[model samples]
Target: MEFDLDYLVQQLPALRAGLLLTMQVSAIAILLSVVVGLLGASARVLRLPLLSPLIAAYVEFIRNTPLLVQLFFIFFGLPSFGLTLSLFWSGVLALTLWAGAFQVENVRGGLAAVSPGLGEAARALGLTRWQYLRLVGLPLAVRSGLPAMLNTGVSLVKNSAYVSAIGLQDLAGVAFDRIASDFRAFEMLAVLLVGYLALVLSLSAAVRLLEHRLQAPFRR
Candidate 1:
């Protein structure tokens, strides 16, 4: 089958819209997930009496379950319980919860690296536990866990394709829709691969740059 450059070019507007929506959803989810990670990690690290075990359970459950199942539950199942979200918010919530689980582990691992001496010192200096965590622990932990967090961001971006299942017109959804009508599997697939590759690579480059800046303080 001949590759239709003209057809691909003609589809650029739809592809562009899809790409924008994908990026928007990913950005919101990634940002929110990081917040969830920080809070969840802090709770677990501090061993909060009531919250820590529940957070641990949440992390484990989200990590263990399939994201698609989670997505379906949020988008489809929730309506049965009298709670319904718009497709965009539903996608964002699903991705945030899924990535937030991994981010919690990543940030917790970073928090675990904090020296016991520091905690003792904070206590000696009369810093409240919350103050110590916010002023010292989280800053250091976030810096340490940044790479892993960024990796989760990348995965979330790729996983955004799954949002299409809920009828969101993200990149993959647009491509699938076009192929179904035009029967141009080769063209659509090829463009889809390239679009994802470019998006991931761009994200990776940004991650590296951010890492470099964050680690600069530790450099000789």
Candidate 2:
């Protein structure tokens, strides 16, 4: 088989478009995941009456199952109950829920790591539960979990490729189409690999920078 560098170059435009779509979907899903993680973590930490168990079950189920199955359920199964979503929204929703599950545990672990003395001190200081969480708990949990959050972000970006399985025009989807047209499997797959690597590396760098900034005060 011949390596066709020129053929890969010719497909750059489509691949670039696909990359942009992947980034857009990933950005939205990551944001949603963070929100879900924070809320779920808080519920578990506080032991909210009924909500905690539900969140726990959700986290367990999502973490245990394959994301592809979740995506298919969202895109295909929901229509059976008359709940339908567009392909892009379906991908985004599935990714958000899936990532959120792992993130919840990351945050919960961070919350658990908080020293018992701190909570006691907050109570002794007459800090309400809400204030204690906002002023003390949340910051500490986020700081301790920053690395895990970064890992989740990177995972989310890579997993966005799976959206291609549902006919979303993401990087993987576009590459598959191009490969089908030109029959340049090696070249297209190589480009796909490189594209995801660049994305993950860039995201990891940005997260590391943010982590450094967050740690600045502690260094002093």
Top TM-score prediction, candidate number:
2
lDDT of 2 by residue, 1-220 (tens): 7889888788889888999999999999999999999999988888899999999999989989999999999999999999999999999999999999999998988888899899999999999877888899988999999999989999999999999999999999999988888788998899889999999999998988998999999895
Please, what is the TM-score per model?
0.96, 0.97
lDDT of each: 0.93, 0.93
Candidate 2 least-lDDT 10 residues: 1-10
lDDT of 1 by residue, 67-93 (tens): 999999999999999999999999999
Q: Give candidate 1's root-mean-square deviation (CA, Å).
A: 1.1
